[model samples]
Target: MPKLMNVRVTTMDAELEFAIQQTTTGKQLFDQVVKTIGLREVWFFGLQYVDSKGDLTWIKLYKKNEPNNCAGQIMQKLFQPNELEIYPTKVMSQDVKKENPLQFKFRAKFYPEDVAEELIQDITLRLFYLQVKNAILSDEIYCPPETSVLLASYAVQARHGDYDKTTHAPGFLSNDRLLPQRVLDQHKMSKDEWESSITTWWNEHKGMPREDAMMEYLKIAQDLEMYGVNYFEIKNKKGTELWLGVDALGVNIYEKDDKLTPKIGFPWSEIRNISFNDKKFIIKPIDKKAPDFVFFAARIKINKRILALCMGNHELYMRRRKPDTIDVQQMKAQAREEKIAKQQQREKLQLEIAARERAERKYQEFEERLKAMTEDLAKREQDLQNAEDKIRALEEQVKLQQQAREELEARQNELQEMMIRLEESKNLEAAERQKLEDEIRAKQEEVKRIQTEIEIKNEHTRRLEMEVEEARQKKEEANRQLLAVSTTPQHHHVEENDHDENDDLPNGDVTKDLEIDSSIVDPVEERRTLAEKNERLQDQLKALKQDLAQSLDETKETAMDKIHRENVRVGRDKYKTLREIRKGNTKRRVDQFENM
Candidate 1:
């Protein structure tokens, strides 16, 4: 097959984050995950092949594109319409039958277990954290402009980019712990530091606070959890006015457990006394592995502004706490509302898309219709040309036929004239008389010879056929007797099913007519006529018989007796039911060893 140049090879990755925390590996990982999730049945169907040239010739998988051998076999398996696009790719994939160093990364698709719904919140949170970590390690994440809201922390004052309310500073925003103080000075104030300053102002005026600033700030922090933010703090609803800060991955939420006494969860659970004078907390986990707690610290913003303060637990007094972290039902409802809104937007867009598609389709159809009309016009024109040619050829044939007919008529007339003259003459030359007599004698001799040979062969062939047939009948009868003897033991169980109705009985008069007509079977015309005649005679006989036996016609026959006539009908139709084939078990079970 000739190769075509139009082929595309692109790689795509599965966009889903891990369903469970797993070390990514081979098929077992997916299998284990799916098993853990509990899916009932899974069937995967796809052609997996790599293209040596990185060109997918999946089109060859289709019947039209298939080479003589394995073509179309795989296509029939998948049978997806979009599979047409992949067929060319499949063919190209054959080029990679041998291992190639080139490897293609592909996306994974999830065919979730039955009844599983999307856990958007769960999945998104994990992915966001992974992205942040990857970006930190790779540094290819984002280099946002200084005007970016995230850059407004007081720790890194305006040295460039786009933070509006800051100076190109030589001093660093004191709280940035990651970068050197000098490098920190090169960037602008982060939003968290500025927000902390605002919170401090709000605290100073707590007696005359403009609004419920503290409560609102708490609410914002709570909402941030839903936005993939892990770090969170609670101001005493009554204590800390509003101190906003970031921790280096450790957070101490001041609260009370069931005892209503201060019970704080922190990295340093055993520390007798601890305090944060510098407001910088570095969480060094003591467990075997990193603790599963949401390594809560990432980035921070206070009062819609940046700050450079990191927080840690400063041992302090606390109060009993009763809290609702998440409301599942309300969250579901909110998600549903958002989904509906999105659906409406999508549907409206889809309507526009569909309308445009319909218009395009109609235009395409019109174009095709026009092309068809043009083709039809061309066909009709060609047909007309052919008709004209045929007419000319037929005229020539007619003229030739007419000429031949005229010559034949002329010859016939001449023959008639000669015959008339010959009949009237009555006298013949002696030589001519002798020649006629000799010709008649020769013809008569030839006819006798043919008749004699034909008679002899006919009798001999018939006699030989008769003897052969008789011998064949005897042999067949003997074979049947032997078979019946062999089968006798098996039949003993159903001794009743043993008659020859197959040979003796048929539907109404159909059997008798068939038998009577068999004699003439070698001649189709005679056989049909004989069968019809027998049928008429049988019908008359049946009517007479029925009239005589009308009183006894109601007698019922038992099914067992019918079976006793074992030469019964085996219908082709019964083969449609599998159970009918099962009936052959008895015959198959019975075996006889025959030896000469």
Candidate 2:
């Protein structure tokens, strides 16, 4: 029986354990984690583990040859152990308990080239947010103090809804680690001051959704100098310590002191091959004229990790060049639908919460007033009983009349307010309707214009077609006439010196010959005229065909434009209808409140 190994993979929020064969490849384990998380954009993530050397390494989730055949097989063979297979001997730690399961962290190993455009899935974005937040807090990525404060505010908003004064008092962030220790150490302000600055920014994101807040955080984080770069401490050929960085674009070498800027860069497109043996790594450029990049790591384990990262980054770079697969398309569509649904749900929930809070406040106020009025009435009744009972009755009647007048005035004011709001809503609705109508009319006019133009082009095309056909027929007829003129036999006159031929011919024949000679036309001149006319007809036919083709192309473009406009108009109408429905619901709610 094969041995079953208990492997634990830690994600952003939770740890997942899986029982697999001891010989399970990295690809299988990675796939299991992705399936468990329901992550569609798997390209941006990788499973990270601490090797025996205490260096972080990415698990090779795919075969090297899977990306391309050029250098894949060679690299695959060079990095033995089946691309860092899951083995107890490789990952076991001396101080750790033997009974504990093998641990791995599922993390965002790569970032999108463009966050807003490429990062589509909410789940993917959330994972990135969690990883980036941890990095920022841990000082793994260097963030300026100002930018760190801004990121911390977004983090706070994402974690705890909005910053409430009652809940988030002083020392709220003191216990929680928001910014890096370095950032705090550099600033002279107290912790309270930093919290206040963060709260100021947090207040501005009051109603922002958690996903939006997270997205905003990522957008800012992506701009930092060390955002998505994975840095490895290594030595150059000169024995100088340097940092080798690998990111989505390419590999970069940073100086020993400065991590913000790179000393040299090699884009993935320029790189032809990457191979390493022992602690020696080399990067060959596509341009033979350029020298190869050679660097050395402290341990062979580090070289393996660097190679794995480079391969993965290169594969992703190539993948992005191709079109999206069907699965990707479906995932994008589903993510969009889910995003819209979640937004609607959050809006509805917020609306309900606000309305409930308002009602509760009003009820509390009414109850307090009623309690005070009851106490006053009781005191008055007590005093009246002690004095004149008849006077007490008059006082009660006056109090009742005063209360009625006050209630009437309040009701009138409310009615007036409702009326004003209703009038304003009506005016806004009228303006919106008029605008929509005008837009619809304009669209209709545009459509009609395009249609009219298309019709004109079609008519012109038909006319050109007719002209081309006529010209072709004329050309063919001219060719046939020229052929007939060429084929026609000509009479040959015998010389007068041939006495025998003259004696044999009758005088009538001679007179006939004279008449024939006089009636004969110049065939060469006639043929030349027919040929010229044919050439002219051919030129006209060619011109007509060219005009017809141009008209057809114009007609096609016009039709496409019409279709695009119609789609836009339909989308606008749908949006307007939704807005109207929402307005109607609001009006109904107001009416119900007024009645109550």
Candidate 3:
């Protein structure tokens, strides 16, 4: 029975886990990876992992492991504890005349519909950052402009996530923190100064949001050394358009869609003769017995130029090795590999130390956050308590105001009743004055009738007096005659008639005296003056009532204003306390975070 080893494969875009038989070659895993990811152009890439020595070495797909290699052996020998990364050995280069590296062409399934532009930009930025990181690590610094752009790309990546080609890429000219850790260490750069410089540049250029700016950075990253190399389109004898790329290794030819399985490869070590004419690129294999020939028709536009460039690159690749250089070259390569392994081990140990430090810092940050949160909660509770107290105070104030309003209303009612009484009194005074005037007029009429009666009586008395005077004269004459005729019998009769007439006159004088006494009345001017005084009193009462009403309104307004001002002052004081507490707590938390 074959035991299976659990292997985790890392690809350019994803990580895959697989279970393979220990007896199998690395090719088995690679084949599965290619199948799972649907990789079409895959030859230029390989699966690699860091050894226990921390040296990153390729997994040889063509070589078979020893029979003793089991799952444990594979784990101990091939895989790292927690790392798996796939790096490219060669990149497919094609005509990019119409292609822009800043722009990403989307594919199906990788990107979701209605995805945010920010997410796409973030991913794009990450890809560029990875490239920049690779360049930095490889020390591929040459062109100043190119290096600056690559560094800028690295800055954007650190701030954002890796880029996915299936999504739209971001714009570039925006990130401010462009100095990556490697660059900082390499140049002994002051992070603050570098950041300030980038900030100034960003401000001047109207910097983009970090995500959207990735596309612009991607364009710059793409223009790095040896990036976007064009592959020549050639026609084989089978009349198929083959994509050909000449690198330091050799000539590589393949179908445009599938690069993992190349149809023909002319390694520099295996080549015998290579030449190109105006219209063709000709190649002859090293083996004389095989007698196989491979010819490529040049591209239509830059055929001669492309052939020339290929010949030049090939010569450079071939010249490195002399006729008898195999054993010496292998020894040199082994020594370099060992040295790289030691360096990698040291770097790994440093990385572990750094990771531990980071963890401690993160833990401290967590503790600070917890403390801050607790303080915030306590402050909130205090605020709530203060708010409740304020509310209670406000309620008490409102109650007092209500009571005051009720009392004021009662007072207002009393004043209103008093005013009503005054009105009634004024009306009564008016009625009394009218009654007195009517009585005065009646008394005057009675007096006038009495005067008329007196005048009539006087006139009658005058007539009587005149008559008496005539009688007196007659009486004197009559007394003389009577004396002469004393014995006449008519004298007794005359005396009796005079007595009756006098008695009637005395009765009339008595009635006239009674009428005169009844005609006299009290002074009317005194009553009139009393009425004027009552009217004046009524006017004064009305004025008093008006003043009282005005006072009530003013008092109410003053009381309300006082209550409102008190409430505002109390609320302001409480709010100020709350703000101070919050500010203190926030400052403490910020300090803790900074220290962490």
Candidate 4:
């Protein structure tokens, strides 16, 4: 059925079996385990397996697992005989005794071992530093005196990139800054002494960068051999507390009371397989000649999951680190002498470098002082230039003000002359106006007299016309009476006789009537003469009135011109005075600016 392989799955608390295809990935198995166990935070979990070299290796989900491909084979493949485990990102170490609880406590010594070994120490050290700092800050762990020294040294290195013997310690590396005041006082190293000591120490690390040195030294202090390790505490039958460290180097068990020394070591080289039940752990060695070793921490009541973890770590170390031969040698006398000579040379060189640094510092101070003086001189020059500019501007302003004053004064003089001329013209116009008024009055009187004479002539002519008409009517009546008398008979004959008689005597009466008729002469001719005179007087009056109007307009124009001239003169005088005042204020401002 689909070429299924029998694979054993192990966890912190239990072990189980699953039938799966060889091609199944770690992710698929991890998911199944999480789903079955109802594990929380599946993302922070992974499956790790031990290889033939006794090194623990993480199974990447993306890559194919070769060992799992074998089915029904007598080989100790990953799934056939061995097991894989689901572990938290930071594996837990359980202390088994008195049924004690499983705690996720990791030791400071195992701090660096958690990071990937392939990563450079520069990067790995940073991780360790942060983890250690957090652990200490949270009071989860404490750093001893020797550990603090290593921390301080590494901290200095991290702050300033790798160490250089030629360069002295930076000012920030002072004991007060790197260490607490109390710590510094306890050490009793003066500033100079502290600096010298750090410098000498920094010079010794010539092989690797500071970060590598820091991590390497930290591992040594913690007494750790490999990365990615888990430590457990267990007790034997006698109730003697013992520690077991499981890493890529198989299982290391402490024999003596001291935790650093290992009494028994299983490198996974002779280990064939592992299995456990509750507090019982068994290791099957590959060498047929050796018997299987069994361990029990019944009093401590070790958890079965911890045994699984131990088996997993043993398999990892067995697979990763292959057994190889190593050659050992001892240092000869010649090598020792050469190393001492190198040390002496390095010390002598440091002395010379210190002397040069002091000289350079003095020169730098002198140069700074020179630069400051030069800057001051430049500032003074700038001030002088500004003052000169102000002076020039004031001078230009004064010249402008003087020129304006001259123009104003000239305008005033011109306006004064114009005023004098306007006054003279005004007087002349007044006299001319008076003369025209007098002439106009005389013409008016003449016109009035002529008008009255024409009116009287018209009346007299009208009366003469009536008298003529009455005389004509009397003549017509007398003719008609004479004709009737002459035609009608005796009376008319009698009158004719009397008329002859009177013709000789009628001389006086007839002459008197003729004279009266001649006396009634037409006055139209006299009236015509008066009318001509009246028209001539009217023309003269019109001409005189026009002249008077012209004279009045001229006087008005002259008066307006005179007023305009006076105003202009006063305005020019005022403008000149204001300009003079403004110039005085400008001069005062210029003086103030100069003083400043």
Candidate 5:
């Protein structure tokens, strides 16, 4: 029976233990882990473990001497290394006890050039995000102060949903180490000031979803100078310490002091070969004129790691240049669909919230209006009570006036006669008002007729102007043709004159001369006719304008006349009212006599 060995694998959020045979290979363990996690894009991830040499290394998943098939040979030639054969083949040592579980970490080993385009699954992006966040907070990845603040803002938004003034108070960020310590030390800002800046940026991502926030964080993080770079300490041929960075694009060499900028770069396309012997690694250039690049690592294991990284990066670079596989295309489409769905869901929720807010505002306005109407109703109720009291007092006055009313009968009869005269005057005023209204209507009809005639005259004038323009163009063309004819040879002109003098000339020549003369004379005559027509149109337009002015003046005069008539009617009404008042005074005096 094969001895059973325990292995513990750690993921981003969880850890799992596997009991396997001691002779199990790394490929078997990796496949089990990926199967357990249900990860489809297996190329981006690998199992990492610390070797006996105390150096972190990727667990090799393939045997050392796999059959060299056609596809394997092709990959080996392109990447210059059989990357599959480089990893540790055996996962467990025979000397390790079954109770002792070896530890391995599931990590994103490869990074894409573009996160938005290459990372498809939510779980994949989340893994990438967590890894990058860990790298940033641990100071493994360096960031500038402003970029650190912005990235912290995205992390805050992703974790806390959104920035709330009450919940995310001043001391809220004291416990959270969102930015790297180096960045904080470099800026020399207070904790509260840094929190304020982060919150300010966080507020800008108000409605961003958590996944979207994470995506944004990754998008920004990928643009940093050290993004996706795996650095190793190495020495050049000159015995100078330098940094070797292997990334998706190519291999880059940096000075020992400065890691932010690269001193020399060799893109994978320009590199012909990469080989390692002991502690020395050699990089052959594609150009024969350029010298080979050589560097020495501190350990052979480091050189092995560098070689593996170079192989993986070069393979990916070549793969990216080709078209995407079917699985990648499908994943991209699915990711797009999911993104659209989430966006639509967010929009729907926002619209619902907006509508609820609008409804709440309308409800508030209605409540205010109802309150004002209630107050008005109370005021009108008080006024109604006062009106009722005045009605009772008027009833008492009516009873007191009943006794003198009969004694004033003769004065009342005389008042009736005055009222008859007033009625006759009112009838005459009504007749005058009707006559004035009729005259105003007739004048308005005349004004409308004048406006219609003006429109017609304007249209006719426009037609005449168009005809005049056409005639002018024809005259200009005729003048141009006559100038051209006169500029021709003098012999041609003399021949034309001789043709005109000779009556015995051919009929065709005579016809041609007549045609030429007609062409010249017709334009002049037509121009004269058009000029006359234009002049007549101008006069007509002017006369119509004058008529329009006259009509407007008449309309204004009619308005003034109406105003004067209204004033006279008002004066007559006032005079009649005065007469009625005088008669009423006389009647009241007679009633006083009767009362005496």
Candidate 6:
């Protein structure tokens, strides 16, 4: 076999992922570059070969690296660009070898993301055309005619991309806009000749395929993220351009009711008289009447920045155009509608918060009031229990007094009977009387001393007035004293005069004591006197205890109430801060997020 072209193939540059992910043209070019140079080891931009003419021949550009081992031909040439846009930086090509004479360089920058698909279709179709150009000139038929037809279809597909005006293809695959040169290069024609041929073919097939406009429109909206509240601007109906000031805010136009409208940034009345540079122009709304231009606007306020929008719908709107105030007014109406919607949402949330707050306040009030009331009720029930106990003690005293009175009456009746029996024994009875009289004399003397002691105790009680707590204890002791008096010898002596000690007796005392001989003193009366003395002393002690506890409790409660008032002040301040946070009237949360 004849010596094949000796060369080395290599790809060197940045990673292919980013470049391939960019424009489709870049991806296609990368692939072709890989196959033509790397896979085939055909490192040359164009191949050199001898034709069947028995003479060396030069041919036009070729797209593929077909072998020239048989009686075929080889072409040498690479595609060129008609226009060159200048860029600030230079780009080093990926595939550069020391032996290769061609300089791999680029002086133009492109937004590969925005126009990736268009670039891919353009490069692919042009290469297909170049392939056909080579075949027609050199008479190579290795590939079928249907392949050429398909390439032609691809070029046509590219021309009607992004909402085709002539085709019915759907989905992302059909968004191409170009005419492949392969269809015209079958006869070895240049792109100029190929374009003229396409014009002739388009005249034959202009209205044959109807396009789906709505599908394309929706795809465009989705691509732009209109659902995310993006804003834009464009020109108005008249022709005037504020070229430099337009795209600053980076806003967009919105669609409503089958019409394009600009969102009003704020209420116009607040912003109308203000110039574009004024900081107070925050009240702009969207303009919804199909826009002619989209302007990106910004107004600075209080050392902060805010975004604003203006947009146009028609293609003509991008040209030198004047804005529509009428459309702006329409936008105000639209803004009002949007404002009403937002207000309704806010109002719903506000009402829920208010209701919850009211409920919480009411519950707190109820709980506090309940605590106070329950405490009071417990105290009252205790007092009632004390009263009930006192009433029971009083009833017991009355019952004991009644029994004592009945017993005394029975004793008197028995004495009367016994006296009558004594009278029958006249002389002996006289002796008994004499003995009784002597005993009475001794009791009278004892009574005089006891009375003196009582006077002294009463004088002491008068001087020492009981405190409230002491008084309560004193009252209990007094009740005991009154009980004691019911069983006392002193109570029997005086029926009507109960004194304070004998208060438990019936309104009138019934017990009466007879003058008794010391030799025959009744043990019951002696026991009663001792009990009364003990009760009187106990009453005084109880009164002192009651007064002490009441005074202490009152002082402690006063101190606690003062502390509670101070705590309420702190609670109110904390609650106020929480209220502002919930209402979003403060920027605390925003600041927190910014700091993070």
Strongest candidate by lDDT: 5
Candidate 4 contains a number of clashing pairs equal to: 24
lDDT scores in order: 0.32, 0.67, 0.44, 0.45, 0.68, 0.33
> Candidate 5 on 383-454: residue-level lDDT in tens?
555555555544554443443344345445555565555556564777775765565556556555655655
| Stretches of candidate 5 exceeding 4 Å from the true structure | 1-3, 66-76, 79-88, 93-99, 164-172, 186-190, 361-596
User: Model 3: runs farther than 4 Å from truth?
Assistant: 10-16, 23-27, 34-43, 49-57, 60-132, 137-146, 153-189, 200-218, 226-596
lDDT of 4 by residue, 111-139 (tens): 32223342232333444554444443332
Query: Model 1, 318: alpha-carbon shift in Å?
Result: 21
lDDT of 2 by residue, 311-348 (tens): 77887787788898898888888888998899789778
Between candidates 2 and 3, the TM-score winner = 2
TM-score of 1: 0.21
Clashes of each: 44, 0, 10, 24, 2, 54
Candidate 2 weakest lDDT stretch, 10 residues: 88-97
Candidate 1 residue runs with Cα over 4 Å from true position: 1-275, 278-307, 310-359, 378-397, 423-596
lDDT of 3 at 369: 58
Candidate 6 lDDT by residue in tens digits, 1-596? 33222222122222222222111232244344445423221111222223333322212222233454452212211122323343221112222232322222211111111221211222222332333333322323222122223233334433453233344422323333223232223234445443443343334332222121112212222222111122222222232221111121222222222111222222111121112323221212233221112222332321011221222111112221345346445645665686577667756666566669777786787677567656655655565566566555555655655565565556556555655655565656667876655554555455455555545544443433333344457556655654553343552232344444645457655444434478864343354342574365346335533432343333333322343335345653222422333332113322222222
Query: Alpha carbon lDDT of residue 475, candidate 2?
Result: 52
Q: How are the candidates ranked when ordered by TM-score, highest leading?
A: 5, 2, 4, 3, 6, 1
Candidate 6 TM-score over all chains jointly: 0.23
Worst 10 residues of 5 by lDDT: 587-596
State TM-scores per candidate.
0.21, 0.55, 0.25, 0.32, 0.58, 0.23
Best by TM-score: 5
Cα lDDT tens digits, model 3, 488-530, are: 3553332223344434664464211111355555233233443
Residue pairs in candidate 5 whose N, alpha carbon or C atoms collide under 3 angstroms: 60-87, 60-88
The model with the greater TM-score, 1 or 4, is 4
